[model samples]
Target: MKALLVKDNLPDFNGHAALYQMTPAHEGHEFVVASAANVPFSGPETYLFPADADGEIKSFAELDGSYRGGLSHAEALSNAGYTIG
Candidate 1:
């Protein structure tokens, strides 16, 4: 399964917004997106976004069709402190 990691732009959470990991909803994971660090998918920090009617999730796309920021896998990995080069 593929996933995208990006900053949460919503102002309500401000600096508290965890780096979000977005992926298509599947059997075990029902959320379209959640906090990247929430592996077990629990706790208040584990923010979840509802999936589409078809159960597919697209990164950086919203209801009004506004453009949001996106990061490549390499960039996300680096941002998550998993790599350096």
Candidate 2:
């Protein structure tokens, strides 16, 4: 599923800042934000969360747990000192 990676004000499992994975709300699935980069988390069962396009759409695979909250995924990748695209 395509998801947006957004900065979460709260820290993650590792006690570090993290991002939120948000998707659209549907029948059984209320609009909620999940933990990005596979942090394994969801919401407190809310239905009033924003469902707009807040961040860049990325595949779940790209959120390979490499992000640890300092810089954004794209920014980190770009500043990795390598010529990666």
Candidate 3:
């Protein structure tokens, strides 16, 4: 099991925005990133990197889990210096 930590201000599937942080999951956590040209998160999940040249989501693995996929998105989030509320 894993956890997804999405930021505040990013809306959910139903176009509602009610952001909150976790109390720390027993399992490791991943981040939910939002960049330009993107819509608010709209699903039971989320993603990080943008699409690729072929318009497929390839850059995603570059910013996934803490070790396996690459640099940890959780660490990346911490590196940004924002306190998790």
C-alpha lDDT values of all predictions: 0.33, 0.30, 0.32
- Candidate 1 residue-wise lDDT, 9-51, digit = tens: 4333312322333333233333333322322333222233334
Encode model 3's per-residue lDDT on 1-85: one tens digit a residue.
3323344344332222222232342222223342222234532322334332222333444333212222333443343333344
Best-first order by lDDT: 1, 3, 2
Report residue 43 deviation for candidate 1 (angstroms).
8.4
Clashing residue pairs, backbone N/CA/C < 3 A, model 3: none
Could you report the Cα RMSD, in angstroms, for every candidate shown? 12.0, 11.9, 12.4
Error of 1 at 29 (Å): 9.8
Count of steric clashes across candidates, in order: 0, 0, 0
Error of 2 at 71 (Å): 18
lDDT (tens digit, per residue) of candidate 2 on 1-85: 3234445443322322333342332222222223223233631211112222342223333222233444343343223221211
- Clash pairs for candidate 2: none
lDDT of 1 at 70: 33
lDDT, candidate 2, at 46: 14
